[model samples]
Target: MKILVIEDDRLIGDGIKAGLGKMGFSIDWFTDGKTGQAALAAASYDAVILDLSLPAMDGLDILRGWRQQGHDEPVLILTARDALEQRVTGLQQGADDYLCKPFALSEVAARLQALIRRRHGQLQPTLSHGAVTLDPGSHTATLNGEPLALKSRELALLQLFLLNAGRVLTRAQLEEKLYSWDHDVSSNAVEVHIHHLRKKLGSQFIRTVHGVGYTLGDS
Candidate 1:
């Protein structure tokens, strides 16, 4: 999944980026709200981590603006512990969840996962299709009870495919979910990752729609 994090605190933002990247998420982080909101307008994201206190634009304004513009992507607000009123206002303005300062990466990740699951209406953390299973929290995948060793991009593709099983995902969609903005994505990037995933999970696990894209199917 692709996430946009708008946070001014470099330490917290970097931690969120690194930690979430390991769990198979592609993150594009902006330290200021103006750039963050512009990025949201220009691109697509599965979710967003928005800090209420921002330099150019307050996080609340950004949230309200997105909501008004009909961008209903899940948004988790970041706030100081003492700002209960502001946190409540954020929720009223369409924030999905809130996390206080000095929080653990584990908790942040867990909350993000919960928000995503709720978006998909799935309560289970493990995603499975046939004999293949991928766990987002642990960054692990298994085929028929056998653990599979995978690279970062490979794991990300597998997770996306499993999450969107039975749907035809175009190359653009795969690329969006698999690579962050900073990553240089070659023309064949998606194909390469798909190739690797097929080798590990079996060729029949992913079916091509010819002119369309790929879909996860039971073999």
Candidate 2:
């Protein structure tokens, strides 16, 4: 999944980026709230992790603006403000979930999973298409009831395909969803991942739409 994290503290930001990155998430982190908001406007993410205190703009104001603009991506408030009113206020401003500082990375990951799943109207913890099944909580995949060995990027790509089964996803969209801003992506990165997945999951698993993109094939 892709996530936008708006946090000012270097330690907290780095920790979130690193921790979440290892868990099969593409994360774009911005220290300033304005910059983060601009990033959100420019691109799409599965969810957002926002901090209340920020420079240039407060988190609540950012949330309000996004809601006003009809950007309904799920947002999880991550801040030090732990009072009852603060929590209620954050929720009222449109945050889907809330977490205080000094929190567990596992909890953050779990909450993000829930938010993204809820956004997609997916209640099950695992995503499946025919013989292929992926468990996001465990970061594991199975094919024909056998364990599937996939790299993180490959797993992410498969997850995207499973999420949008019949829809064609262009190369650009795949790239955007799989990579973060800081990475120096090669020209053939998306193709390389696609090739690897096709090799493992059978060549006919992903159908190529002529002059368009790719879509999940019949299992």
Candidate 3:
């Protein structure tokens, strides 16, 4: 999934970027609130990691603006403020979840996964299509009960396909979800990934709609 992280602290921001990246998420990070908010407006994201304390604009204000403007992507507030009132206010402003500072990367990832799942109306933790099963929390997958060894990008792509099982996804849509702004993606990046996935999971696992796009096929 793609995520936007708006944080001022360099240490925290870098840690989040690296940690989440390892977990198969494409992360776009900005230190200033205005820049982060603008990034959200420019592209699609599965979720947002927002810090209450921000430069140029406050996190709550950003969240309020997004909600008012009907940007319904899930937002998770991660801040140092631990007061009950602050937490309530954040949620009231439309934060889907809240995590206090000095937090674990695992917890943050878990919360983000939950928010994404809820947004997709997915009630199950593991995503499965036929004999394929993926556990986001464990960063693991199994094919026919055997361990599936997949690179991070491949794993993320599979997850995206599973999330939108019946919908046809264009190459542009796949690129948007799979890459951050900083990535200089090649023209055939998505094709290469799709080819790799088909080789590993079988060509019938993903069906191509002639003159259109691709969709998850019967497994």
Ranked by TM-score, top first:
2, 3, 1
Worst ten-residue run, lDDT, model 3?
Answer: 134-143
Report the Cα lDDT for residue 58, model 1: 92
Q: TM-scores of all models?
A: 0.93, 0.98, 0.97
Candidate 2's TM-score: 0.98
C-alpha lDDT of residue 154 in model 1: 88
The candidate that achieves the highest TM-score relative to the unseen native structure: 2
Per-residue lDDT of candidate 2, residues 5-72 (tens digit): 99999999999999999999999999998899999889879999999999999999999999999999
Q: Name the better of 1 and 3 by TM-score.
A: 3
On residues 1-219, what C-alpha lDDT tens digit does candidate 3 reach at each position? 999999999999999999999889999999999999898889999999999999999999999999999999999999999999999999999999999999999999999999999999899999999989999878888989999989899999999999999999999999999998899999999999999988888889999998789999987
- Model 1 lDDT tens row, 1-219: 889999999988899999888877899999998999999988878889999888999999999999999998999997784477877888899999988887888888778877877787678998888888888777788999999999888887887777676689999988887888899989998998888888888888899999999998774
Superposed Cα RMSD, model 3: 0.9
